[model samples]
Target: MLENPVLADLATDLPQAVRLQRLAAHLRARFRCGAVALLQLEADHLRPVAVDGLVPEALGRRFAVSQHPRLAAILARGEVTCFHHDSQLPDPYDGLLDTLVGEPLPVHDCMGTRLEVDGKPWGVLTLDALQTGTFGEDARAALAGYRVLAEAAVRISRLEREVQALRTTPPLRAGDDERGAVGGDADQEIVGQSAPLLRLLHELDVVAASDLPVLLLGETGVGKELFARRLHRQSPRRSKPLVHVNCAALPESLAESELFGHVRGAFSGAVTDRPGRFEAADGGTLFLDEVGELPLPVQAKLLRTLQNGEIQRLGADRPRRVHVRVIAATNRNLREQVTAGAFRADLYHRLSVYPVPIPPLRERGNDVLLIAGRFLELNRARLGLRSLRLSSAAQEALRRYAWPGNIRELEHVISRAALKALSRSGVNRADIVTLEPALLDLESNTAVPPAAAGATPARPPAPPPPAGETGTAPGPLRDVVDACQRAHISAALGRCQGNWAQAARMLEVDASNLHKLARRLGLK
Candidate 1:
């Protein structure tokens, strides 16, 4: 019976999500349904929290209650609601069955019971069967009984989480002191509690209230756009539009017209008068991503706009006044670009009035696990797994790996590992899938030395030249070392498909340092 097992699960200290997953899996097995899913009630949609025998994408999908009449009907009922095979309402689970192929065939029967905590609907537990009349009166009664236990489990899980949060939360730091004082909309997307991430958040909070031009300097995939949005949300112009323009994506021919609008007859393709991003973002913010990619002529025009708050449209005699707070972001070193005459110095200075550098994932310590947990939950739903977890060795591997792609890379790694583990375990498997270190495939760029973990030995350092060997042209020791370093970096880059970040990680050096070294060696 589910009574004892559910009671035992609640007594243990497993994570709330894990406990819920177990209950859902148990109910699915107990009813012997073709598929079962546990959905959590969000504001206007139902989020699949756990599932079995559903396609991988089922978890990541949200079903609107209004759109899915069957789900709405089930949620409205106090008892289990059964749907016949010939029901006219479309099934949200169509083409979502894991065992199915090609087009989705109609299910013969389906049953659902709403789970409630304290008289409020929490979510719904659903069962589907390919055979007609699979859920008889007895099965329906049993599922309804299980729903009561499921609600209790969810309630206890929530309470336990609250208590745990209360216990683990540390006293507020100096940075946090002003958080409540300067309250605005909170960004739930930026997830992390590490010191570095916290410091970044504090800096973001400070700069978000001002209208100063901000420059977000960071590696690729460090979520610059998300931070830019947060800055816009906290500013005085929160109610106004926040327009984004990918400067690198803009064509040189259309860059001016795209940024500053154009009247008819401005260019060959110009048919009607059109307002550009600057006009669209007037009185608000304009986020220029990869601003370093702007052409020299566009740079000059951009400088004029920044200086006088005016943009002259293409083929127009008059300049239009605009009040836009610019937030520019780039992974490139603008100072280097300025030195190379690739970027204007004056524009660089203007955009960098408030520079915020986001820390990379490798430097964020345990924040990796915190961020991984968020992705893990999403993967669990997307992969239709009851639970996804990293083994102890896998967790250590993740912590020790150099994530060159930052949070974006970490997410892909976890997702790939989860999918790999799922496929290996088979379609009908119903246990918590634990991802081991081997599945992470992080050996190529792991920051932790393999010797420490008794894994494969690292490559030996490059040997010194033979005692009697003479160079073709001898130079200073520093020059010889620089030449050798350049050659080694070049080889590493080639092996890594010309990825500088990966080459840097492989060489046990910072990516910026590698770039500077390459530039000094005249190899850039």
Candidate 2:
């Protein structure tokens, strides 16, 4: 017990934090008490840091600051409020302690000291006496001596907060040129912060400063738009507008006019001259979403613009020059499309000047929580939720889900759950303080819910097999081997949480070789 000299000196000397939890354990053994708990106050809250002589499982459980009446009275006014028994105290925490200790805490004999440092309430150091009338004034005074060290620990915390505040500055305005040079929390925006995502962010940082055409390849709803937006924000054209066009949404009849502006009376609908997306996005960026959906004819026009940096308005003879960077996104296999004559080989080469592939949510390690936290903050007010938190079980559920819609799907789940809770009658906003397992329950049960009424499914890509291979019973060795290899890498990536090195190690290949295979298989 004397080995905890650090704690003894802290009561008078340097006044730093000392656990002495071992000492508390020894004390419990010597005194034969039901429980001995150390509750420390920090950051304006009373947190239970250590415990002894009680259930081992409840060791790290915490009670809210000043929530328990007896503890509150002791710390608030230096009055040693006594609990005759656990039943008399009103169950503070679902009665875990009462059940664990096998009896209500002895009220008449139980005593604890109000730890006050520099005359301010810091914490409570208590020893519960199970027998009747076993504690008196002497015990409270003995525990009070530990206050000095507790105060020093609080000082250290204050210093650390100050240091962090100094390091993180506020974001710059959109108009600021500097905003384009250095992005606003680029890594944080990426969600996962996993090893693969970190490396991806590093690559983004290196490429964002240039005006290179970036092709984002990923499965549907894998946050390609977010990466494109980040790229625009970090580029020299940050101040310029970013125009988004879904190539798949455009009708073939008007796709050309929509892309490269038309002159007056070019067609029946062209009553007046109109600038197309190319002209509108002059000196900015044009994000061609679902690039593979562009008709072959439209693809030829797009190729010309990318190659020549010029656009010719419809019904006009001369071409007009426009300086605009292009960012294309596709969930389709462009290489297969090229072979099938659905997509232009020339356009593919032009758009993929710089390609960045995004991994799916299931492959992103622990990003489920990160995206969940961000979505909660963003939609809390819109959903009319006062306070919310994810339960441990709910967090586990979110981690387990393979989010087919990626970050977009996660946001929808949180928004739908919060709104549903708010609409419930007699439920006060404060009552909905935490998002429990029930909120996540709605997401997993149904693939599509009435709550997510208008959500469109992401269309699957076309087959990669050759026409002959599809009819045959089996393909050649190389084709079957390639199919198996892609499936293996994709499964391994999901299992390893997008850690390329670990996935490579499991596959027994060099990391560089794995990278080559991933590119060939299109498993990002």
Q: Taking the candidates one at a time, how many backbone clashes does each contain?
A: 1, 3
- The lDDT values for all models are 0.73, 0.62
Look at candidate 1 and give me any clashing residue pairs.
Answer: 59-381
Query: For this target, which candidate reaches the highest lDDT against the unseen true structure?
Result: 1
Root-mean-square deviation of each candidate, in angstroms?
13.2, 14.9
* Model 1, position 523: C-alpha lDDT score: 40
Q: What shift in Å separates residue 343 of candidate 1 from its native position after superposition?
A: 0.5
Best by TM-score: 1
Question: How well does each candidate superpose onto the true structure, as a TM-score?
Answer: 0.55, 0.53
Kindly list the per-residue Cα lDDT of model 2 for residues 178-269, writing each as its tens digit. Answer: 44533443232455456677777767766877889999988756778778887787666777778889775676789999999899999998
lDDT of each residue in 1-524, candidate 1, tens digit only: 55888788978888776897888677767888778988878766687777887654456456667767889999999899999888876566754565544334455689998989888999898898877888999998888788778888888987896676445333333543312222332223566657898888767767777789999987665789888887776666766788999886676788989999999998898999999999999988999997877888999999999999999999999999999999999866778668767789999999999999888777888778767766776676676664466665676887887765577767767887787787773643245566788777664322221111112223434634744575554544654575467457655654443445556788999766876675454344
lDDT of candidate model 1 versus the reference: 0.73
